[model samples]
Target: MSALEERNRRVLVIDDNVEIHRYLREILEGGAEDAEFDAMDAALFGTGAGPIAMRFDVTSVYRGEDGIEAARRAREEGAPFSLAFVDVRMPAGIDGVETLERIWGEDPEMQAVICTAHAEVSWNRILARLGAPQRFLVLKKPFDAVEVRQMACALTEKWLQEANLRQGEARTRAMLIAVPDAMLRVSTEGRCEDLRAVGAPQLELDDMLPGQAAVAAREAVASVLAGGPTEVFEVEREDLGRLYEARVARAGEGDALLLLRDVTDRRRAELAAAQRQLHEETIAAQAEMMLALSTPLLPIHEDVVVMPLVGALDSRRVEKVREVLIQGVADRGVSIAILDMTGVPSLDAELVDEIVATARAIRLLGAESVLTGLGSGVARTLVEQGADLGGIRIHRDLGAGVAYALRARGGRAARS
Candidate 1:
């Protein structure tokens, strides 16, 4: 900012003496002759420095009560006085010490200078009343103008620097709150220096994180400090059955940062999904093997083949039977195909129709279809369903069916 637009350096002067107020105004407001002041300033500071470039917005009050009110008002308006000059002997009203106490109540950070006569107020009394001597200084009556000027400059600058530092710290804390996880900064030896957790529960330094997690975190911090790459690892809470993900990275020259987030629910969901997929794949493989077992095609002679049908039949299984039987008859160039069904305990109308369709499909491929081992219930189902079992031979068992198939294939039947 330009010099004219910069913030004012505010100061408050509280004393009953009008001359004291006027003299302070002249000293702090730049009305003195510069040439004479320069020589004195050079002797005082041991260097030839010009007058302070910063300007002071000074407020003067004759009574201690009035000074307290003025300080309060200044603070409320966001332009608090950086320093206050208070006189101990205010005969008309409350003394300087009480005035300062009330004013500090309004703005505790305001730097103070207690102006008192040689023995008017004891330093012990002042220290006892104030408690923090670092915030105020004792300036005896008949103080030199140059000394007062130097004190004001140093104290006001100290106040401003401290205020800036506090603001910076506040901003840093706000940024840490924005992070949605537990965070800790640790020394190279694994001692936690700072901890912040806006999204999770707050953790203590001595207690550290928790259980095995604390040990893992310390190891991660050490690894990062030793120039190892950033590491991510999981720590499970056996008591709670919960898991956490911890990430460690170098924060600076001598410290590392560890961030932690809970991941128990996510891990559980992934494992469940994997198990479901594996179960589905296993069922599919078993179904394929069962289909093959139910429709085993065995060659009994040069031109004859026998297919044993077992288990309950659905539309899907019926289609599988058709595919295997037609493909086998055509590939083998067989003249006779025997279908044995001794293990089939029962049949429905739909299944009987599907069986007739399979036998007709075999006949279309230039093969004679023979059915054997038909249970009484299965024969009754075929009659009830009025199935067209044309151009197909029926026998009582597999041996009888194989003999018929071989005789129809122009080979003599071999008795088994």
Candidate 2:
């Protein structure tokens, strides 16, 4: 940009001197490609500001009364003046300072430059009346054209910067309020500058209050301010039908943020998973037990395994029982083999023949068979069916049968 364009020119000239008005407008508005102009003569005093150019706008007035009136009318029309050149020595209707006050009331951002040559009009007097005089500029009557243009251009840029700053602040505040979570602003000095709770519920923090004002529910804030590692703390409350657990955490330096979600569902899911694990273990144990019982087993101890035989003996059971007795006797190295028929219901002729063959089979294998679950009725039926048991020994119960077998073997030993 050129020196003129960088100034961003928009000039409002208010003076009683017709030549002065023309001079101020000419010097302030000329040589700008994007500036607006409303050049006015003394006769055009009370006309309001011109229409706002899309880029910039400027207006001029003749008298102080006319300037104040035009300022009011420009404000009503929503086209604010940016830079005003006010003459100090005006007629008694109003002076430059009073007009300056009214101009600010209409548009607070308008920058004014007091144009004067009077020694009696002190600097403090005009400044004190115009509120914060540093915001304005003052040029003497004998100033050159370049000096007037410089002052006007500087004030115009100053107004634009001020307007930009105010708009930026307004936008920032709007964004801050739109956040969904609670936000806190603190300094490193442990001073809380601001706190805004967006979705947090109102709590009875009378007892937990910090300072004198509820301690502000700010553990997370305190953690951040102390330069500690960020941490999460759970606070449970039964406020809902079920329990609700709140997880609070520190977010960043000088700031703490909070997000809340219900975790009752997650807890229940964990519990259900544990129960399913236990049920699976139980099923595995039951399967192991069935496997142990259904399959045959080797004898585990040096003791007898008394397997009593009952109902009609099938050939499959006869073979299984024979295998159990022979293996048990051989493994334990025991002396007696007693076949006590105490509960046999109705032995098949062929099955009885198989049982005797099994006992003989046990003898050959260095062990013996003992069948103890037969009754007298089964014995008689076995004899009537012509089942063969001539060479095998039998007994009603284990005691008498073992005694007879012992004596008979002893007699054979004595004879030998």
Candidate 3:
């Protein structure tokens, strides 16, 4: 025991017998021979011990009146006794039981043990009082002085340990509640035992989690408690504003810690990855579509033919139009070629010449080229530019162009 703490303990024994004082005095200063051995291991099996057993102090008084005076003095001095021993029957103005009441009125935490020759009466009245019955002990007549010392040492030690624990718990609570992390203590069944307002400010009471989150918390609650110090998990949740991901963890001796943090940034990065995947998918689809449109060659029938002219022009589609006309005639062997101008989105003077040149190319291939589906916007543009296209036939629709081709085909067949 530290000198300061040992000197601080005061034990007031209220009894009329002077020999009782001498006896109690010897017990209070008991040596190692007075201790009970290996008999109380039940309370220390799992808890860290030995460190808690080394500090204790004891004092004893011989008279009820004297004991009461000493108790009052101790209280006035601001360091009251930690525990007391009181005999029920005593030669004084008040009895031991009444003196106990007066003593506690001064220091409520003082532990007391009742010493008496008459156990029955003392016990009966002692149990009925406002003082906790468990705090008072019964000592029969003709008890061993050494045994009294042992009990005094044990009970006083127990009371000091309890006082220390209560004070320590209060201090810890102050620290735990003020921590800056979003932390909680969760039970084995996934119920939040306590909440610390850190990362998750809304984690109050029974509302720590919602929606799919509750289910996910349940899944990992067991793994935390599978006989380990702590465990961590990453999970997802959707709140009123957005989706969030979180990292949760368990800590402490019972595997009961729970902690959460907002992981919105991580989730956003994942979303961007998914969008990139979708973009790649769309590109793949468009490529396959272009391949399908180009499969049939020109004049696989005289009735239908399509030509796609493609290339990047100078802010225009010029060579694209010329290729369409040549493909329409040579490949389909049509008497009339419908010049597909759909791919030619814009034009300049050179682009216009490319369209006129395409008509000449169709004639050279032994097929007359008819311009079809020229958007009014493009036709007006071409007319304003005054491009000469008297050589090219004009049709409003592909069907009309096809009819013209068929008519010329009939004429050629008749000549043959």
Say which candidate scores most in TM-score. 1
| CA lDDT, candidate 2, residue 142 | 72
* lDDT (Cα, tens digit) per residue for candidate 3, span 1-416: 45335543566666778787766665664445434332244355533443223323545666666677787888888877767878778765678788888777767677787777874675566777744876767777677865676677667676677778878877776787775445566666555655443344333323767745666665556665665434455545544454444334556545455666556676778889999999999997775565434332355244445453333234233443455456655665666656655545555666666677777787888766677766665687688888788878877766666666666567442344
Clashes of 2: 10
Error of 2 at 142 (Å): 1.6
TM-score of each: 0.55, 0.46, 0.43
- The lDDT ranking, best first, is 1, 3, 2
Estimate candidate 2's RMSD in Å: 15.0
Model 3 alpha-carbon miss at residue 229, Å: 9.0
Instruction: Give the alpha-carbon lDDT of every model.
Output: 0.83, 0.61, 0.62
- The Cα error of candidate 2 at residue 268, in Å, is 14
Alpha-carbon runs more than 4 Å astray in model 1: 1-180, 197-216, 296-303, 308-312, 322-403, 412-416
lDDT of 2 at 204: 38
User: 1-416, model 2: which lDDT tens digit per residue?
Assistant: 44435443556778877888766655654545324233342225433434322222456777787887777776678666778888898775688888888878777778888989898888888767776876788888876987876776577778878888888877776676675433444433334333443344444333222343323346555665576555454444444434333333455655554443446677789889999999999998886564434323333223323444445556666666666667666777744556555556677667777777867776676554555545666777677877666556666675555455446456442344
Deviation of model 3 at 112, angstroms = 2.2
